[model samples]
Target: MEPDEVDFAHTDAADRKRREKATELARFAWDRAISGAELLELPDDRLRKLARAAGANPPSTRETWTVVADLLDQKSAWAAANPDHPQASPAHADEKIMWVKRPIPPWT
Candidate 1:
């Protein structure tokens, strides 16, 4: 194995390890969110705050709300499908407030 090949192998292994760690963290977060441990009904401001705290570049306020709303809708659908499952009942399953904004027309 040449020196360059050894360096490349080390870099590849490090990158793979980082990716595995990220995947594990994501899976943990997902499980918590689905189990209702992590609240998903956060308003835009709170969402932004959380994102900033996590060192993440959050989307725009409108986009944040849209994504949360969509996730809630999916959770509700899952709950409806799995009525007997305990994790199916999300925190915002009963929320009726609209979250999506109307799209602007190109001609406007």
Candidate 2:
């Protein structure tokens, strides 16, 4: 294989693992939010502690969970209010997430 291809292949597993971990953490945070425990209400230190308790290894900070909680809350609230909506659940919208990515500035 070419050098670039080999490099990408090696990195692919790590990337996938990272994505999985992020999603898992997000899910945990989402559940907590839905249960009336808003993840964003915690400070960064508290979030990291909670994430560790939730099995996130190194633990994501509140800032990271804040973003996840926000998106999850939006989806959750909408789904609760509009039970008949086509895209009403995370399971139904997982594939659609890819299409929502916007180009980020290089600095970001």
Candidate 3:
């Protein structure tokens, strides 16, 4: 669909609201990623707020899973570019992953 036609997917006011909220949350996540915060650091309440902004109930497990997956992608990219940088959480040991950006698919 053309760029303008994308709005058609959420023609209803409620649907539009939900989309906007979700987009905001995603943007916030990206901002935090840029600032060197772990995606999991985002509290559930914040995610719920984003869901509310989208005019829907707070995100479900599936949505959270998607968020985490995207975060891992970011972390991987960061690691490749900055191998010398310290991990996000050395104490946790599990937080040693880097951040990476998802490549824009040519299809877009």
Candidate 4:
């Protein structure tokens, strides 16, 4: 009945779609990136450094997947909102991707 309420009602579906698409796309790219690498159980601080290069700013307390997932979420959300922009693969789509992390030391 109220204008603000009506507006919210209309946008609720779009919001859900955006979030779903964002999560889906982000996970797909992350999955691809780690598909072949050996799984290392490193501390959150060390792992976040790698995710940071990929463009996510997750806190130092999150797990590796959570860190990367946050990155993917951000990228996909951006892509979905700006559909005209390059949607190829946000993780691999940017110019800053030239960043390469140093190799992870072997587990002790």
Candidate with maximal TM-score: 2
Better of 1 and 4 by lDDT: 4
| Clashes in predicted model 4 | 0
TM-score of 1: 0.35
Between 3 and 4, whose TM-score is larger? 3
- Local accuracy of candidate 2 as per-residue lDDT tens digits, 37-68: 44545556655655585587754333345445
For all candidates in order, the CA lDDT equals 0.45, 0.54, 0.49, 0.46
What tens digits encode model 4's per-residue C-alpha lDDT throughout 41-72?
Answer: 34456445544543555433333354345665
User: Which candidate tops lDDT?
Assistant: 2
- Evaluate model 1: give its lDDT: 0.45
Tell me how candidate 3 scores on lDDT.
0.49
Q: Model 2, residue 102: displacement in angstroms?
A: 32
Candidate 2 stretches with Cα past 4 Å from truth are 1-10, 34-42, 59-108
For model 3, residues 44-95, the per-residue Cα lDDT tens digits are 6755654464356665554443544465466557767887776632333332
Ranking by lDDT: 2, 3, 4, 1
Cα lDDT tens digits, model 1, 19-107, are 44433332333343432223354456755654454345554434333444455455657768998997764334232122222346898
| RMSD to native, candidate 1 | 10.0
Give the runs in model 4 whose Cα sits over 4 Å from its true position.
Answer: 1-62, 88-108
The pairs that clash in candidate 1 are: none
